[model samples]
Target: MAWVTWRQHRPQLVAAAGLLFALAAAALGTRIPIEAAFHRESLAACLPPAARTGCDIIVPHFEAEFGGLVTSVRVLTVLPVLAGLFVGAPLLARELELGTYRFAWTQGVTRRRWLLSKTALLAAATVIAGAAASAIVMWWRAPYDILEGRISPSSFDIEGLVVPAYALFALVLGVLAGLVFRRTVAAMTATLLAFGATRFLVTEFVRPHFLAPLHRVVLATDSGRGPGDWVLSDTLVDGGGRQITAAREDLAVTHAQLAGIDPHTYIVTLGWKRLIAYQPAGRFWDFQLLEAGLFVGLAALIVLVTVWLVRRTAT
Candidate 1:
C-alpha cells in the first residue's frame, strides 16, 4: 500500500520537496546580510528607548535594505492554499475523473484502508513540507521578529506549529472538495475558495477572542503596549468610563497650550486615560497551540467526512 501510494503521488511529493528546497535556499541567502546588519548596527541594544538616540536612522536604513524581502516572506501565508490546490485537490479528483476509482476499488484492498493509506501518506508529506518551509522562514525572520513582534499577523501565521496545522487543514479540505466535486479543476477551485474563506474568518474573528484579552489603564501620554503585544483596542476614556470625544480632546489641548502645559499631561491631569485590551508577548506559545489545535481538529473531522463519503461511494 505504501509503495502504491508512493508510485501514485511521486510527482506531488517531488514538487513539494523542490519547493521547500528553493525556499530554504532563498532564506539562507538572505539571512546572512540581515544578521550582519543586526549585529553591525547593534540593533539589540537599541530596543530600549534610552539606547535609541539614533536608532531612528539606523532602523529605517536596515528596514529599507530588507523591507522588500520581509514583504515577500509575508506573502507566503498563502502557501497552504497552494499546497491544497496542487496536491490535495487532485488526489482523489483525478482518480474519480479518469474512472480509475472503479478499478482501484475492485482490487483486494478495502475502500476504507485504501483511502486512509493515501490520505495518511499525502498528509504527512504536506505537514513535513509546511514544517520545513516554516523553519526556513522563521530562521530568516528571527532578527526582524526580535526587533519587532511576532504577534503581528504576517509573522504569526508563518511560524510555529500553526503553519503545519494550517497545511494539514488545507490538504484535508481539498480532499473533501475532491470527493464532492469529482472533477479535478472544480475540486481545486473549491478548495482554494473554502480554504481562503476559512482562513479569513479565523484570522479576523476567532483568533482575537481565543482568550479574554488583558485590559490595562495607563496615562494618555503613555502607550503601555510593547512591540510584540497584540493590542485589540486602545481607547481614550474618562474616569466615568465614557470615551472622550475628539472635539473635547482638541479643546482640552488648546486650553493646555494656553496654560503653558503639555497637552498630554493636561489630559492625564483631567483624569483621561488610555484603556488598552491586548494579548501580551508572553502568550505566544499558548496562542500557537490554541490555533494549531483548532485547525488540526477541523482537519480530522474533514478527513472523517471524506472517508465516509468514499465508503458510501464504494458500496
Candidate 2:
C-alpha cells in the first residue's frame, strides 16, 4: 500500500518538497543580514523604556531596510491553500477523472483501506511541509516579532503548530471536494473557494472569541494598548457607563485647547475613561494550541466524511 501510494503521488511529493526548499532558501538568505543588523544595532536593548529613545532611530532604519521582506511574508499565508489545490485536490480527483480508480479498485484492496492509505500518506507529507515552512518563517521574522509581537494576525498565521494544522485542514478539504466533484479542475476550484472562505470566517469571527478577552479601563492619556496586544476595541466612556461620542470628543478637545489646557488632561478631568478589550501577548501559545486543535479536529471530521463517501460510492 505504501509503495503504491508513493508511486502514485511521487510527482506531488517532489513538487511540494521543492517548494518548501525554495521557501527555506529565501528565508535563510534574508535572515542573515537581518540578524547581523539586529546585533549591531543592539535592537534587544532598544525594546526597553530606558533605551527606547536612543533605539528609535535604529528601529526605523531597520524597518526601512527590511520592511519589504516583512510585507512579503504575508504571502506565505496562502501556502496551505496552494498545497490543497496541488496535493489534496488532485489526490482522488485525478484518479476518478482518468478512470484509473476503476482499475485500481478491482484489485484485492478494500476501498476504505485504499482511501485511508492515500489520504494518510498525502496528509502526512502536507503536515511535514507545513512544519518546515513555519519554522523557517518564524525564525526569519523573530526580530520583528519581538518588537511588534506574534499575536497579530499576520504573524500568528505563520508560526507554531497552527500552520501545519491549517495545511491538514486544507488538504482534507481538498480531498473531500475532489471526492464530491470527481473532476480535478472542479475539485481544485472548489478546494480553493472552500478553504479561503473557511479561513476568512475563522480569522474574522472565530479567532477573537477563542478566549474571553481581558478588559481594562485607563486614562485617555494612557498610550493606547500595549505593543503586540490584539486590541478588540478601544472606546471612551464616562463614569456613568455612557459611551462618549466622537463628536463630543472633538468638542471637548477644541474647548480644552481654547482654554489653554491639555486636551487629554481636560478629557480625563471630565472623567472619561478609555475602555480597552484585548488579548495580551502572553496568550500566544495558548491561542496557537486552541486554533491548531480546532483545525485538526475539523480535518479529522472531514476525513471521516470523505472515507464514508468513498466507501459508499465504491464498486
Candidate 3:
C-alpha cells in the first residue's frame, strides 16, 4: 500500500517538493534587501515603547518602500489549500471515477486499509509541507513582524501550528469531498469553496473572541496601544461618555483649530475619551494554539467519517 501510494502520487509529491523549494529560495532571496534596509535605517532604535524616539521619518519610509512586497507574500496562505485541490481531492476520486476502484479495492486489501494507507501517507506529507512552508515564511517575515505585528490577518494565517493544522483539515475535507462526489474536479471545487468559507468564518467572526478581548478606555491622544496589540475598535466619545455625534465631531475639530491645539488634545481637554477593545500581543501564542486545535480536531472527525464510509464501500 505504501509503495503503491508513492507510485500513484509521485507527481504530486514531486510538485509539492519543488514548490516548497521555490518558496524557500524566493523567501531567502527577498530577505537580503529587506533586512539590509531595516539595518541601514537603524530602525532597531525605533522599536516599541520608545517608537517615538526617532522613527518619525525612517519607519514610515521603510514600510512604504517595502510594504507592497511584504503584503504580496500574504498570498502564501493558499499553500495549504493546494494540498486539498491536488493531493487529497484526487486520492479516491480518480480511482472511483475511472472505475479502477474495482481492481484497487479487490486486490486482497480491505477498503479501510487502502483508504488509511493512502490518506495517512498524504496527510503526513501535507502537514510537513505546510509546516515547512510556514516556518520559511515566518523567518522571512520576522523583520516586518518586529515592525508591525504578527496577530494581523496577513501574518497570523501563515506563521504557526495553525498552518499545518489548516493543511491537515483541508486534506481531509478534500478526501471527504472526493468520497462523496466521486469526481475529482467537483471534489476539488467543493474543497476549495468549503475551505475558503470556513477560513473566512473563523478569521472574521470566531478568532477575535477566542479569549475575550480586553476592553479599556484611554485618552484619544494617548492611543494607549502597545506594539503588537490587535486593537479592534478605537471610538471617540464625548464628555457625556457617549459616542460623539457628527455635529459634536465637527465642533471638536473646529474648537481644536480655534484653540490651535491638536484635535486629540482638545478632545481630551473636553473630557472626551477613546474606548478601546484589543487583544494583547501576549495572546498571540494562545490564539495560535486555540485555532490550531480547532482545525486539528475537525480533521480528526473527518478522518473518522472517511474511515466509516470506506469500510462500508462496495468493492
Candidate 4:
C-alpha cells in the first residue's frame, strides 16, 4: 500500500520539495540584519549633549527588504486549497465517473480500505509538505519579527504557520467534495470556493475579534502647550524634551499662539496614544492548541464525510 501510494503521488511530493526549496532560497536572500539597525553605537556622538534623550529605538526599518518574501510565503494560503483540488478532487470522482472503481472493487479490495488507505497516504504527504513550508516562513520572518514587535506572545499564540493543519484541512475538504459531487471538475470548483470562504472569514473577521477588547483614552493638555493635539509616527517621541510637533510645519500658528499664552509661565502638556492591548486572558498554550485543534477537527470531520460518501457511491 505504501509503495503504491508513493508511486501514485510522487509528482506532488516533488512539487512540494520544489516549493520548499524556493522559499528557503528567498528567505536567505532577503534577510536584514537587526543588530545594526537597532543597536547603533554612534547615535550619541551625532547628537548634542543638550539633545541627548531616552527613547524606544526599536530596530531600524527592515520591512522593505523582507516584505516581498513575507508575501511570497503567503502563497501557502492558497497552496493547500489547490493541492486538495488537484489530488483529492479527482480521487474518487474520476474513478467513479469513468467506471474504473468497479474493476478495483471486484479485485478483493474493500471500498472502505481503499478509501482509508488513499486518504491516509495523501494526508500524511500533505502534512509533511505543509510543515516544511511553515518552518521556512517562520525562520525567514524571525529577525524582523523580533524588531517589529510581531514575535510578541499574542502573535506566536495565534494562527502563525500557514501549513500542516491548514493544508490537511484543505486536502480533506477537497476529498469530501469529490466524493459527494462525484465529478472531478465540480468537486474542484466546490473545494476552491469552500476553502476561499473559510480562509477569508477566519482571517478577516474571526481572528481579530477572538477575545479582543476595545478601550478609549482622553488626553488633556495645558492651554499654553504648543498644539492642542498631535499624532506622530509611533516611533517618534519627545525624548529630547521638545514638543511632539516641534518640527512640524502645520503647527506654526499653534506654536505662535502658545508663545503668547505663556512666555513667562511654562505649561506641561499630556499627549495620549490610544493602543489596544491584547494580553492573553489566560495561558498561551491554550489558544495555540485551541487553534490547531479546531482546524484539525474540521479536517477530521471532512475526512469522515469523504469516507461516508466514498463507501456509499464509489461501489
- Ranked by lDDT, top first: 3, 2, 1, 4
lDDT per residue (tens digit) for residues 274-309 in model 1: 989988777778888999999999999999999988
Model 1 scores worst on lDDT over the 10 consecutive residues at 47-56
The pairs that clash in candidate 4 are: none
Better of 1 and 4 by TM-score: 1
Q: How does candidate 3 fare on TM-score?
A: 0.90
Candidate 2: residue 21 lDDT (0-100):
89
Q: Rate the local accuracy (lDDT) of all candidates.
A: 0.87, 0.88, 0.89, 0.58
Tens-digit lDDT track for model 2 on 1-315? Answer: 889989988888888889988988988888999999999988888774645566757877988898898988999999888778988898888889999899888789987888898889888888989999899899999998887788878889989888999999999999999999989999999999998898889888998999999988988788776777998889999988788999988999999999999998898899999999998988999999999999999999999999889988853
How would you encode candidate 4's per-residue C-alpha lDDT over 1-315 as one tens digit per residue? Answer: 678667767877788788778867876765545334433533323222324444223112344544565555555556667677877787777877788778766667688887888889898888877777667666665554443333233234222444577788888888788777889899999989998888677645554444443322223232221111111112212324333454442354366466775421222232322222242323233444555567788889887777776666724
Q: List the residue pairs that clash in candidate 2.
A: none
User: What's each prediction's clash count?
Assistant: 0, 0, 0, 0
Off by over 4 Å in 3: 221-225, 239-241, 244-269
Query: For every candidate structure, what is the RMSD over all alpha carbons to the true structure, in angstroms?
Result: 3.0, 2.4, 2.7, 9.1
Error of 4 at 93 (Å): 2.2
CA deviation > 4 Å runs, candidate 2: 48-53, 250-269
1 or 2, greater by lDDT: 2
